[model samples]
Target: MPEFSDELCARLREAFQRTRYDADGVLEALGAAAHAALGRGEPELAFRVSRYAGELGTLIRLFLLGGSEPSAEVEAALAPVTIEDALAVGLLRADGESLAAGLDIRPHGDEQGEWWVISDLDSDLLGGEVPPEHVLGVGHASLSLIRATIRRPVGTLLDLGTGCGVQALHGARHARRVTATDVSARALALADATFRLNGLDVELARGEWFAPVARRRFDQIVCNPPFVVGPPRVDYTYRDSGLAGDDASALVVRQLPAFLTEGGVGQLLASWLHVDGEDWADRVTRWLPPRADAWFVQRDVADPGLYVGTWLRDAGIDPRSPEGRAKASAWLDWFADNKVQGVGFGFVTLRRAEVAHPTIVCEDLRHAFDDPLGPEAGGWLDRVAWLREHGDDLLATRFRVPATVLLETVAGPGEEGWETTIRRLHRTDGPGWQHELDELATALLAGCRGALPLSDLLELLSFAHGDSVEELQDAALPMVRELVRHGMLEAA
Candidate 1:
């Protein structure tokens, strides 16, 4: 682990700034193509491009590309922080006359700001399998959680499995106080160093799940837990929870409400099993506790073979290798014995609320979203709460469709000229959801302009279609509720 102190961290920050070793600086040094290649785990282009990029290039080669540079060059690149101090803090190791990075430190940023993250070198860079307790750097899953997280300002935030403290860094931007916990000691140490280097104060604790924060409640919580489903064996501390099958995800979901304040929100990435002769949504929905509103959006599903192979490759094990073959066989046999047909991966958002009937939605949302989901998630919670409050008088509420909502129609040439084949309502923003509509539903929706209540619209439609008002109201209310749930309609 790296030794951390206020003075040492300040000196390192100065060195990084002097060399311009950040996301933007790196992009400038290495052209757009090479920078993107580096992101894809191919460092050949970066190695060639950064050969003449000056001090910034040297820092990039040493820290990111996993290259060894002469001691003199490394010392010059780290001007304020001396070579002795760097070596003492375990940031560098001497190989003859050249110095190599002891750990992986890469620049990471989002819309909020830029900062450096420290962790163990990836398995690809290490040229073999990583250790059991390896702390992971920023990867695809980390970035996905960062983008999917709801970032509203809150009093206190909890980052559950803060592996390298990436989520905590982002939480500090909007949260008044942040506390991060992990079961791995190495992860906690690297997380501490990461927070100190960025000049942010985050409370760090060591425990399993929510043990460290027992009896404490938070306004918001974000987690990307070790949710990989597998046999009860821990190969990696960052991906496996040593629980059989998807029990780890179930445990986290079941325990969320106890640690959240009233009306608090919790967002996390999880994996669940799709067992034989069972509905996946029902399996996941059963994990929710009472007095809580929850939403599960499954983005992808993989069959048993694909799921096993994917995780095996992620652990740096070649499927053709002897050890890999054995592990895969045993994993597949376990899946067969447990009757797991596939695995589903997605995001879960939960809100702790006291209500008679909580809004629990479990659906598959595989569409690509253009806008950030943070705002959409907050808006969904607010809209659902509003709908629940006005459930008794929903017929009297004035509703209006947002401008982003579009009515799409597909037409085909029939014997009677052009005829409508399909009618659908599409939301152009957020999740890009589409719902099929019938002629009656379309006519009723056209009347939702905020000037009249739903009951009035139903009466007008009944008079125009020559049907009873009660019959029209019963038919339109369900469609209106569905539209409101997806943000297609809003109360005036």
Candidate 2:
């Protein structure tokens, strides 16, 4: 079993470290390893390995495009994963190769152990002289979100913190010309390769945040920045943005105005501080730019200790080591000293509204959601302007939506329902849902041709099913909200 494991792990690491665009050899080897690993019936190991496919795809392309790395560094990253806890996120099986079901990882815990692994991409070809790396490799969930949430069309795209340039690759497919920028030259070089590998041609630049793009605005921007708080490691380029604590996420929020064209859209995955003495919502709200309306959803939060331990593991720290424990303690104290209650990890989306005096919708919600990059995301990008202008929300919008609304579902029938969200362009506050509901009431008002009042909406439904108006209203409200939230329906 050890010999078999070593061989299989070696292939996977090679596939990960060596595969490139149109280089199907490494991927094939990986697919075999993936199958073998799953056959071992290690669910966690299988899932863990699955993340590398996207990551390696980006890295190999990056390296192919003049991105060099140290051989020793690459070899270390390629080390085998045979430990139990390390194997949990993925598995190695000979017969259990088949996934139980396709899933985008749903992350919890403050430490974000798997995210660090998924987001960072490297190769061993260079001699480790290219400086530290800051990356934003594609994860299944984020890709899914991009595909699902974007409902409207786009003309130009910009990818910040391009990492392996996966999002830039996806954006290149839709936009006429894409500009993918990163603070790291390694990332930019790889982004160049990613474009070429995908048969795309993109504009690549290196700078801190918006420095390179100064005065140049974009129609659509995609960012997967490193919002991790405190000193993630000595690797400054990849981990620290030098933001004041959790305010790192705010860098994106703060600098948004300079780069967005009027009516342009930006989607981000960020983290915010759960300040000890203040409300997190308020703290994050301050991060929004002067005028851009935005929608912020606080998906999950983690405590200091759990957060510290989690990140320690991501750095592949050995719990048995005394040094690991000391480092863990320091990280926890950092979280505590800043008065951070918990760290907020979630999505923050912004769009410059067409109208002046924009209204922002800032919300801290607990709901299930998927990636915004799918077909739905484009529509979402386009439709958000509707919320920006008409104040008609998905849950409350009253436009006569297509009789058949689109349902973006995951592969399996048992997958959870996907929630739709709206973001502000810049500065804003909640009660965002109320505005949507108001519009919905109007839509119901107009959908009924003003022939019925809100109180009697239930009665109208009764005519269709012979059920009482109260019973129909009870069932219809949830459905209407869902539709409005998803951009399938509009406010009256």
Candidate 3:
């Protein structure tokens, strides 16, 4: 590992900014095909297409594609800092008359802005299994968690298992104070470099899980812990916890309440095992502490064979080899012995409340979104809280449908007329959920212009349907609740 100093980091940041070596700029320079090829780990296309000796090309070849470049060209590309300064900072290594990248430094950002992240060379680039202490760069799951996180401005936020400090860095944008905790010292070192290079100040804590923050409370907590399920042994610290199947996630959920302040929220990316006889929602909800309200959205699920193969391929294991075959057999046997039906992977958003009976909503939301979902998550959780408080007085609540809600009617062919077609409400925002509309519900919703109470709508619907208001409420309450819960109808 190479040590980084503040002065050298400042010079390096200056160099990167000068080269415009950011994500958008790099994509523009590489074009679409080469960029896509690079994502698939085939750098040959990028090398062939991006054959320029300019500063940007030289920077991309040396750092991203892991190719050696003439020392003079590199020196010209980074003029102010000589090759000697680059070598001293451990970013470059001299190979005869050429220089090669000694680390993986890349630009990562979202709509907020761009910042450079420094981590160990990717295992794919290395063409081998990663070492135990390998700190990963921005991964797909990390990006998903970043997008899924509710970014309401927080007083103090804690990012547990903050590898490379990506989540902590994001926390800096919306938090007054951010604290990052990691068990691996090398990971913390990379995270420290990431914070300094980006001109961010975050408190770093070196400990496992909540040990470093014991007795301290935070308004918000985010974690992408090592929740991968495996046998008793651990291969990678960044992916596995050496615990039994799914226990790592259970442990995190159990410890969340003690460290969360009143009304605090926690967002986590985790995987849980689905046993033969247990419902996934019930099994996961049982892990939460008392009074911790949560919405568990299962994004994907895979059976034992597929899960094992997916992770094995991730570790660069060849399934045809004897060692790989034995490992797969062992994993299958473990799953069979434990009666594991499947594994569920997803995000869990939890909030602490003082209610005697807490609310827990779990659903499989493998759905599409119109944009980044951070704000939508916070809004939905706030709505859930409101629903809990106003459940008994729902009839008197005035509600309006958002503008994004659209009604679509699908008519049958030929003999069937438009009136016989099915009507549904489609939302243009998150998930794009479609709710089927019956005659009564349709009439009531079409008249919801935020002026009349729900009771009035129900009475009108009852008069039109030749039923009493009480009967209509009995039939419509569940549908109204579902619509309100999913943002089809908002309380005015």
Top candidate on lDDT is: 1
Give one digit per residue, the lDDT tens place, for model 2 in 161-254: 8776667656655688888888877556545544442345678889988888888999888887767787544544655676657666887888
Clashes found in each candidate (C-alpha, N, C closer than 3 A): 0, 75, 0
Give all candidates' CA lDDT scores: 0.91, 0.53, 0.85
- Against the hidden true structure, what lDDT does model 2 obtain? 0.53
**Which window of ten consecutive residues has the lowest lDDT sum in model 3?**
412-421
Error of 3 at 319 (Å): 2.4
Q: What is the C-alpha lDDT profile of model 3 across 100-155, one tens digit per residue?
A: 88778899987789998888777666677678888888888899999989888989
lDDT of 2 at 372: 33
Candidate 2 contains a number of clashing pairs equal to 75
Superposition TM-score, candidate 1 onto the true structure: 0.97
RMSD (Cα, Å) of model 2: 13.7
lDDT by residue (1-492, candidate 1, tens digit) is 656788998988998999999999999999999999987879999999998899999999999998999999999998888999988878888878899998899899987679999898887767787889999998888888887888888999999999999999999999999999999999999999999999999999999999999999999999999999979989999999999999899989999888999999999999999999999999999999999999898988999899888888887888889989999999999999999989999989999999889999888887677676777778888878988989778799999999999999999999999999899999999888789998889898898999999999888988898999998888888788889989999888
Rank order by TM-score, top first?
1, 3, 2
* Better by lDDT, candidate 3 or 1: 1
